[model samples]
Target: SSPLPTTVFEDEATAAQKAIDALKAQGIQRIVLLSHIGYSNDKSIAAKLTDVDVIVGGDSHTLLGDFSAYGITSSGSYPTMAKNKDGDTVCIVQASEYSKAMGELTVNFNAKQSVDSCSGKEHLLLGETFTRKDAAGKTVTLAGADLDEVKAIIAKDAQLWSLKPDASAEAVLQGYAGKVDALKKEVIGTASDLLCLERIPGMGYSKTPGCAEATRAHGGDISNLVAFAFRDMSITSEIAIQNAGGVRIDVPAGDVTIGTAYTLLPFANSLFELDMTGTEIKAVLEEAVEYAVKSGGSTGAYPYAAGLRWTVDLSKPAGSRFSNLEFKGKKDSAWTPLDMGRTYKVVTNSFLAVTGGDGYVTFKKVNDAGRGLDTYLDYAQSFVDYTKKTKVLNRLPVSEYSTQAIYDKNGLLQQ
Candidate 1:
């Protein structure tokens, strides 16, 4: 919404020059620039670039399904394309962002008006409502009904819009639907009645979510599932980390599709492992906690862990947010500080691996860190491999994940 540089548009002058160049070459009377430029910029470009006929743009994601009613030019500039002092054909169209609807207009070219005519004309008036006045000055509803006729007629037929390259068009096209029957079918994953989705239940010992529990049960069960599936690369004996933001979609507990996994991890991120010490791990844990709270918490509610678990004290400084970090290798052993010098294998998504995401910058110093690998196939393959071997994940509790540290002579450990 902010008026910043757009990914789609470079500059209006350059864009307009391109339009003019195209017209001179083809000897075309009209040109259009469908754009995502905000309403104001669209007018400025249209006014400066006089050679174009129409612009069917996209960016602001405005809904032209109703069609725009009117376009105002700069105070000194001429009207729009459709009407010039010389009355030429010009139009602009755009449907709002997202996939709700669109608008269109049909023009019957008249042979009388010379094609070169450019005067006080307004190009497009494709709003939800347009009125005409009568002898008594009563308003005229040129098109009847809001949702019924005019809107669809114009959205599908007319030619008035700015440039919206990536925005989806409402052209009538077939959409394929699948897995209709598969939804009701039984999934063959390991069935456990104790599978819990809540983090801290009101009952006795809170049972974690299956997905979370699975990651804890087998560090990197979630991240490594995909990491090891890649050719010549597998997560081995490391603390695999998954930031909450990356898992965009929740895995459905049913017959899953190859597409489902793709949707769950849509971002194009590679998998790479890091050899970090427990000191670095502590820094990341605290950072993750702080990042979670800063991002409205809900998105970060599900903290990730592979070979370790750390709790945070919200009152502490953000970088050192976590007050406790420990690893678990045996039962009856209390959690302890991680060794600073010891290196721990770490696998994470490429976003954080290079960019120092989630405030883990220590790894940024390790440039020759990881082998770039596609994790999508690895993820799909992991599920496939799991189903073949066993459905049940047998996820262990988060309590099993603790940092490693040796106590003093008295065997008393330090945080």
Candidate 2:
């Protein structure tokens, strides 16, 4: 048998240009790129391409419109306009993350095959019923005048859509609903307390009461736990790293089910192990913090880890921000200063294991050097397995948290 040829991947702009050229050759004058490279990359691609007129993007999960009336903050305006290399108009848009909203954009092209204008808004899909917590802290569904007032508010907001489920779709779903419901109901374990989900510490964005106060100094509880699970499942790995964005949703105090695990780590990512020196690990953390906090990138790029801890001062420059790095091989081991020359096995999701995602350039270098190995373990399943083995989920001891302390940009300590 002949040796198989290796596949060579091209950069986004190059690949997009090649496809656009083919389309133009086929008499397609207007090009709309259905992109998953994320909002930031989409804007860069739009600026580089001459033929692409519009970009519908994903991956970053950016909300590209004003949705404040619904108590949601948006990243930018809908149909963010840019200019191509030829100085022609290019429009880019993205809906929010987690299927919470849908973007609708309209582009008008002139006879010369250039974009003349673009406009649109995101519609937040909602059900007919609404609920609120009463003075007694019990959830209750609205009714009577309250229901009417809620309906009126929805009617007034053009971006809010309250739609009933389609009868035919409901019938189709019913066929498989029984098995799906059974799978979703399979309880793996229980949480002793609400594990709050927050991308960045001190943001006060956690929905659970007291979560913000608890996590303001330590960072996200769920993200740290997910990183610990990855390290635990890897068996031989000494450390684990996870991007905050990878773990989604809070785990309320109660039974943790298969559905909960899936919802938490929803992406189709697998576990990967990389042999890295402490110096490399430090560089990776700096890169993540630089991109997310210092460079005004997505807060989701913030790094979380098991077996590692550091204090970050936002007032300092990127390279100098992280300090007092420590490492422990096992839960029972004493924490010691990280040795820059020592090599250790690090486990992380496939997303951060590769280069160019979330500014983890050091991971790319180690992977390219042939020191990386894929465990082929589904990340979400790893958490499920961990839950079953432990039988209980509780907030990790304060000492085990990855972030020991953080200082704000003004050099004041964050509470």
- Candidate with top lDDT is 2
TM-score against truth, every candidate: 0.51, 0.64
- The whole-model C-alpha lDDT of candidate 1 against the native structure comes to 0.47
By summed lDDT, the worst window of 10 consecutive residues in model 2 runs over 1-10
Lowest summed lDDT across 10 adjacent residues in model 1 is found at: 197-206
Best by TM-score: 2
lDDT of 1 by residue, 159-261 (tens): 4422343324423221212343343233445433333232211111223455444333223333323322321233353456666555544444444444544
Each candidate's clash count: 67, 0
In model 2, the Cα lDDT at residue 354 comes to: 67
Segments of candidate 1 deviating more than 4 angstroms: 1-31, 34-53, 64-92, 105-176, 179-188, 198-233, 245-283, 295-298, 326-345, 350-384, 401-415
| Cα lDDT of model 2 by residue, 44-103, tens digit | 888888788988899998987787776788888898999998899999999887877888
RMSD value for candidate 2: 7.9
